[model samples]
Target: MLEARDMTLTELADQVGITIANLSILKNGRAKAIRFTTLTKLCEVLSCQPGDLLTFDPD
Candidate 1:
């Protein structure tokens, strides 16, 4: 998604009022949970829906 938008992690973090490390965690799929507020901010900046950011994986 970031790639599609030509956005960098640092830029996202700055726009979302989050830290690069935290965004990095989400980027790496190491996040256990994401707050609705944060999710909304991400969608707002990236011009995407939550479904665009979420995926269902069965392992």
Candidate 2:
């Protein structure tokens, strides 16, 4: 979504009020958890729904 919006990670980090390292963790799918506030901010900035950003499938 960032790329689609022509946004850099740094820009997104700033917009989302997080450090680059934290954003990288989320971007890399290495994060074990995400705050609702953060998720809301990401959805707002990325112009996407949670379903567009994350997938759930029980194994």
Candidate 3:
């Protein structure tokens, strides 16, 4: 998704109003939580729905 947007991590972070380090944590899947406000910003900036950014794979 990140690559598909042609956006660097830094660029997305800026657009999403988050720090690069925080975005890195989310990208690496180490984030224990996410605020709805932040999630909304991410979805908006990424031009994607929440479902597109997240998946439920019970594997």
Candidate 4:
């Protein structure tokens, strides 16, 4: 989605008030959880729904 939006990690990190490393962790799907506030900010900035940012894979 970031690539599709032409947004860089650094740019998003700054916009989201998070460190690049933390954002990278979420971006890489290595994050065990995400704060609702952070998720809200991401959705606002990315102009997307939460569903767009998350996937449910039962594997």
Prediction RMSDs, each to the true structure: 1.0, 1.3, 1.6, 1.0
lDDT of 2 by residue, 1-59 (tens): 88899999999999999999999998888788899999999999999998877765454
- The digit string of per-residue lDDT tens for model 3 on 1-59 reads 89998989999998888999999998887787889998999998988888887766555
Range of the 10 consecutive residues with the lowest summed lDDT in candidate 1: 50-59
For model 4, state the Cα shift of residue 46 in Å: 0.4
In candidate 1 the C-alpha lDDT for residue 16 amounts to: 97
* Candidate 2 displacement at residue 14 in angstroms: 0.2
Candidate 4 lDDT over residue span 13-47, tens digit each = 99999999999899888888999999999999999
Candidate 1 lDDT over 1-59, as tens digits, reads 88999999999999999999999998888888999999999999999999998877765
lDDT (C-alpha, whole model) for all candidates? 0.92, 0.91, 0.88, 0.93
Error (Å) of candidate 4 at residue 9 is 0.4
- The lDDT, on a scale of 0 to 1, for candidate 3 is 0.88
Candidate ranking (lDDT, best to worst): 4, 1, 2, 3
> Which residue pairs show collisions in model 2?
none
- Report the poorest 10 consecutive residues by lDDT, candidate 3: 50-59
Candidate 4 CA-lDDT value: 0.93
**With candidate 3 superimposed using the best TM-score fit, by how many Å does residue 13's alpha carbon deviate from the native?**
0.6
